[model samples]
Target: MEGTIVRRVIPSDNSCLFNAVGYIMEHDKHKAPELRQVIAATVASDPKKYSEAFLGKPNEEYCAWILNPEKWGGAIELSILAEYYGREIAAYDIQTTRCDLYGQGKNYQERVMLIYDGLHYDALAMSPSDGAPEEFDQTIFAVRNDRTLGPVEGLTLNLVKEQQRKRSYTDTANFTLRCGVCQIGVIGQKEAVQHAEATGHVNFQEYK
Candidate 1:
C-alpha cells in the first residue's frame, strides 16, 4: 500500500517555484505566468497586509518584481501560493533536510511537497511503486491521514539521503558566483546580493 515517493526535477528557468507548485496543484508545469499574476494581484490589492516593511520593498515594486518571470520566489511566494491553493505546502530542504510547512495552522485539508536544493525547487510525488512513470504520480496527500503522511515523509527522507550522497545539494552560503554583466566574482548569496545591490547587476551564474 505504500508507494514510491520521488523527486520530480523542474527546469531552472527562474520560475521553478511556480512550476513546481503548478505541477503539484494542477499537473501543469507552465503555470508560472498565471500564478505570478495571482501573487502580483493579491499584493497589489492588499496594501495594508503586504506593506513595504513586510515585503522589504514598496508594495508596487515588490509586485512588479514578483511579476517578472526572471526573478525567483522564496518564502513570501510559497506562503502566498499555499494560501491561494488552499493547501499546506511542505518544502524539504536538501542541505538541512528540514521541512518548512506553510499553511500549517490554517487547517488545510490536503498537502503537497516541494524539494529545495538551496537554489532550485522541484515537485515531489508518489507513484504506485518504484520504476513507475510520473503519469501515475499522486501529488496531493490528505493532511490528517497518518497512513499517507508517515510513509511519504519516510520516502522523502530516503530521497534526501540519496541526493546528499550524490552531493546534489548547493551550499549557498559558500557557493561562488560571477556576475554575468561584469564577470566579477562573489562568494555566497549574501555577497552576491551585496554585489547586485552595489553594481546594479542582476545576472549571476554559479561557478566552481
Candidate 2:
C-alpha cells in the first residue's frame, strides 16, 4: 500500500515547508519563495493573532527570517498556509508524537499530509483513482480517518521511509553527530570533530 500511494519529495533546502506546500498544491517549486513571502507577510501583518505562545521568535523577527531561503519552516509556516489557503492541513510529527489539524475555520472539504520528522516537511497524498500524478487542489485530496482500507493506514511507516530517503540526499553535516567517547551530541561534522578534538575523543555516530 505504501508503494502504491504516492509521495512527493521537496528539495532538501530550508524552504522545505514552502516546497512541500507547493508540491501538494501542484505548483512549481520555483514559486515557493513567493508563497513563503505571502505567509510571512500575513504573520507580520497580524502578529497578535497568529503569535501563539509556542512561537519561538517574535512575530516580526520570525517573519523576516522566514523570508530568507536558508531559514527552515515548521508549525508557524504550516498554520499560516492553512489559513491563507483556507484549507485544512494535517501534520504528523514522528519525533514529537504530535498530530494536529489546522485551518478548521473554513470547510475546505479537503486535506493533505505534512510529514514532520522534527526537522523537515514532505508532502504526501493519495495516488488518485487513475494512478496518475496531476496538479490537483490539495483541498480535494480525499483522506479517510476510518483507518481500514485507506491511505491513512501504514502512513507513519511510509512517512518515516520518505524522511530517510530525503536525508540520504542531504549533507551529513546537517545531521546531529554524537561523540561516542563522551556520549554527547552536537550538530554538524565540524562541531562533532571540534568536540572530539577538544575532548581527545575520536569515535562518533550520527543521529537522525
Candidate 3:
C-alpha cells in the first residue's frame, strides 16, 4: 500500500476521455474541450489513417463527432493524445487487469493513468503526499504486472458508476422531444407525453 497511486475521478460525462487526458496533463478537467479539439484535428488531418476500419465511422464524420462535447472518447483518442503529448499513457482495464502502454518514448520519465471499467474511463495519478511518481509504465508493466495495482480504498468504482449514471440522466434530458404520430414538436417531456396521449400516438421520439 505504501507505493499505491491515488486515482482522481474525472466527470463521467461522455467527454470523460478528454477530461481524463486533460486532468493528466494539466490537473484541470476544464481543459477537456481543448484537448478534444486537438485530437479531432489530428484525426481530421489523417482520415485514411483513422478510417472506418479502425474508427467505426467514415473519417470525416468521425472527426466531427469526436469533437462534440456529448461524444465519448476511447482508445483511438487516448493513443492520439499519448503521441501528441510525447508522454506515455498507461490504460488499465480493471476487470481484466490488462495494462496497455501508449506513446513512443523510451525513457519513461513521465506517465499518467487511465482506468477503464468495462463501460467508462477515469484518470489516475500519484497522490502528492505519497512521494514522487514513478515511471508508471515500468511500475505497472515491469514490477507489478501480475497484481492489481491501486490504493487500498480501491479504484473508485462506486464513484465511477454513480457519476456515469448521473451524466447519462442529464444527457438524456437534453434530447429534443417530438411526437412520432403527429409529427409535431413538443417543448418538454410533459408536453410530449401529453400530446401523445391526446393524439393516441403511443410512439414519440427525442430527436434534435
| TM-score to native of every candidate shown | 0.87, 0.64, 0.59
lDDT of 3 by residue, 1-208 (tens): 3443555667655577887777777666777779878988998888778889989989888878777776667778888988887677877666455567777345444566777754456776654344454334122222133332334224434433444554422122244666666788776545654665577564555565
- Least accurate 10 contiguous residues by lDDT in model 2: 139-148
Output the better candidate (2/3) by lDDT: 2
lDDT-superior candidate, 1 or 3: 1
Q: What lDDT does each candidate get?
A: 0.89, 0.64, 0.63
- Candidate No. with top lDDT: 1
lDDT digits (tens) for residues 58-159 of candidate 2: 887777877877666766677778877766777766544456777755666566667665545777665544356545323235544442225454654565
TM-score of candidate 1 relative to the true fold: 0.87
Clashing pairs in 3: none
How does residue 130 of candidate 1 score in lDDT?
Answer: 78
RMSD of each: 2.8, 7.6, 10.1
lDDT of 1 at 139: 98
Residue-level lDDT for 121 in candidate 1: 98
